[model samples]
Target: MLAHNQDSLKRTPLYSLHVSLGGKMVPFAGYDMPVQYPAGVLKEHLHARAAAGLFDVSHMGQIALRPKSGKLADAARALERLVPQDIVAIAEGRQRYAQFTNADGGILDDLMVANFGDHLFLVVNAACKDADEAHLRANLSGECIIEQLADRALIALQGPKAEAVLGKLCAEAPAMKFMDAGPHEIAGIKCFVSRSGYTGEDGFEISVPAGDAERLARMLLDNPDVLPIGLGARDSLRLEAGLCLYGHDIDTATTPVEAALEWSVQKSRRSGGARAGGFPGAETILAHFDGGASRRRVGLRAEGRAPVREGALLFADSAGGEPIGKVTSGGFGPSLSAPVAMGYVPTNLSALGTKLFAEVRGQRLAVQVAAMPFVKNTYKR
Candidate 1:
C-alpha cells in the first residue's frame, strides 16, 4: 500500500537523476513530476519516434493478488465480474488491458492485469490508485491475497530503436516480443520488464526496486539514443496514437461500447450467453452490443494551424450554426505535424469524411470526421 503521508511526494528514486538531466519538475498525481526538458515537447516526441526516451513513471501503482485457496483462474473469473475481458484464458507473464466499471457501466479506471506465476500483477494509474485499491479489496472474494508494490519504481523506454538501446542494458532484451513480459537483470538490478507501452511504438516497461531505480535510470539515459521525457510529451504521444485518456476520453460517464473499446469485451460476455453479463452494468453494456451506442467517439481533423483545445464547441458546418458536440482532447500533433482531436458526435455524424466545424474563438474552423491515429502505429508483433 502507498504511504499516505505528505512526505511521499517529496522524492522518487530518480529524483536527483531527473534534476541532473535538466528535467523541469511539476506536481502531478501527488508527486513531483517532470513536464519536459530543454528539448521541449516537439523534439521529445520526434526523438521517441526515431530513438528511445526514458520516462520516470514510478508514481504508478503496482499491486499483486493471488487466490487464497484454489488456482488463479477462479480469482481471475471473479475479476471478470468487474471488467469485460476473459481473464481466465490469460496466460502467465502476459498482460491484458482492461477497465473497471460502475453499476451504470461507466468506466472507473483502466488498468493492466498481468498474470504472473500463480498471481495477478496490476499496474494502475496513480491518480486513481486509492479508489481502485478500495474497489478491488471490497469486490474481490475473501479467498484471495492483495499485496501492493508501492516501493517499486517503474520506467518506460519507447520508440523505434528502443530494443537496441535496451539491449545494451540487458542482453535478453532482444528476445522479448510485443505484450510479452519477464524478469531480467539490468546491470545487476532485477526488474519486471514488459515489452509494452502507452506510445504506439516498440518499447519496454521496467519495474525495479525503489532503491535501485536511480542507478538503472542513469544507465539507460547514458545511452546516446535515450533522453528523459515527461508527462506533457506522454499525453501528446498517446493522443497522436489515438489512445484514450481515462478522465478526458473516458470516464464513469462513458461506457465501453460508446468509447469504441468493444474489443476489450470478450464474445462470451454477450447477452444471454453461458458466461453472459456477470459484471456490474452488464445489462446496459450488453444491450449496447445488440443495438448501438447513443454517441460514438471519433477522430477530428481541424483546418489551418490553430489547435483546438478541450471544451471547444463543434458546429454543423462552416456557418457556425447548431452545436453538435464538444472537443474532449485536442492539440497540435508533433508527429503528424498537424492539429488532431477526439470527441463524441451523433452516431450518424461519426462517419469518416463527414463535414463539421470546430468553433475556435470567433472563427468557425472547417473540420471533418477522419480516421484515427493520424500516424500509423509501429507496434512490434
Candidate 2:
C-alpha cells in the first residue's frame, strides 16, 4: 500500500461509518483508509471467502467518456486509441478489464471500462487516477468528453452471497452475470452497479452519489451476512486469487504479457485482426503477443510456513548467487493457510514445479513455482 502525508490525507464518504465500526485507519493512496475492523484481517479474509464483505473503495477514480458526436461507437473508438482492448466491440451494459500502456509496452495503469449505452465509464486505480485523468484528457479530448465523477462514492459487496445480498435491494442484481454492468436503483438510490470485484469472488461494485453513500452502505451492512472489510483483507483476497496489484505485481517496467495478463488483450486488437494495433506500445506489445517476453510473472509457494515478503531476492539455487528475480507481492494467504507469492522469473524458470530460492531474513528459503489462484475462483459466470 502506498503512503501519503498524514496531514493531507483525504477521507471517503464512509469515514464516519468506518470509525464507528472500530476500523484501524491507515494511509493508502493518499486517503485515510480502513485496513481492518475489530474482527481483524485474518477473520475478515476468511469471512469474505465464506460469506460477504462490504468495502469502501470510494478512493478510486471514476470518469465518464461521452462522445461529442452523440454516438457510443465514437467514444469507444477514441478510447481504443489509448488501450489495446477492442473497446468499440464492447456491448452496451457490459464491462472489460484493460490497461493504459506506455510507448515502451509497459503498463501505465490498469482499469475497468464499462459501456453505459451512451457513454463509457472508467474506474482507475487511486494512486494513478490523477495522471490517468490527464492522459485521457490530452489524448481523447478532441473526440469525447472526459468528465470525472467527483460526486460519486464507490463500494464493493463481494463473496459467494453477494448476488443474494444485493438482489434483495435491486431485482436486477440477480440477472447480472460476470462482467455485467449497468444502472439500477438500489434502496431508492440511483447507482451504477457492476457484477465485478477485486476479490476473485462473485460480487458487485456500486457507484453511488457521495451524498447517499453512507445511507446505502448502512442498508447493505444491515444484512447479517455482510461484514465491513478493509484494505488488509482486500490485499490478501486478491493475492490468493492470483490478481495483480498495480505498482507492485505490474508497473511501468512490466508489460501486460509479462504480468500474465495477455488474456485481457482480445484477439480483435492483435495482429491481423479487425482493429489490430493502434494503441500506445502497439508494436512492442503486439510483438510480445507472437514472441513471449523474457521474464514472466508466476506464483510461488514457500517451502515452509514462513512467508516470503515483497522485495525478497530470488535465485535459481539455494546457494548464494546473483539475484535472478525479486518477489513483487508475497504474504501468507489466509485462504490457503500457507505462504503464497508472485514474482517475475525467467520464462524458462516459470514452469510449475520449478524450484527456486528466496532470500528472507538473511537466509535463502526454498520456493517452488506453483499454479496461480492457490484457491480456486468462485466467480459467478
State candidate 2's TM-score. Answer: 0.98
Candidate 1 local lDDT, 1-381, one digit each (tens)? 344554557567887887887889887888888899989988998898889988988888888888887589878988888798778877887888899989999999999888876888888988888888889899885857777888899999999989998888799988888887767888889899999998888999999999999888888888899988988899888888889988899999999999999988878777766688888898889988989988888889987888988888888877836888888999999988899999988888999999888888988888889897777788777
Enumerate clash totals for all models, in the order shown.
0, 0
Give lDDT: candidate 2, residue 133: 98
Residue 311's lDDT in candidate 2: 99
Runs in model 1 deviating more than 4 A are 1-10, 272-274
lDDT of each: 0.86, 0.95
How many clashes in candidate 2? Answer: 0
Top candidate when judged by lDDT against the true structure: 2
Q: Give the Cα RMSD of candidate 1.
A: 2.9
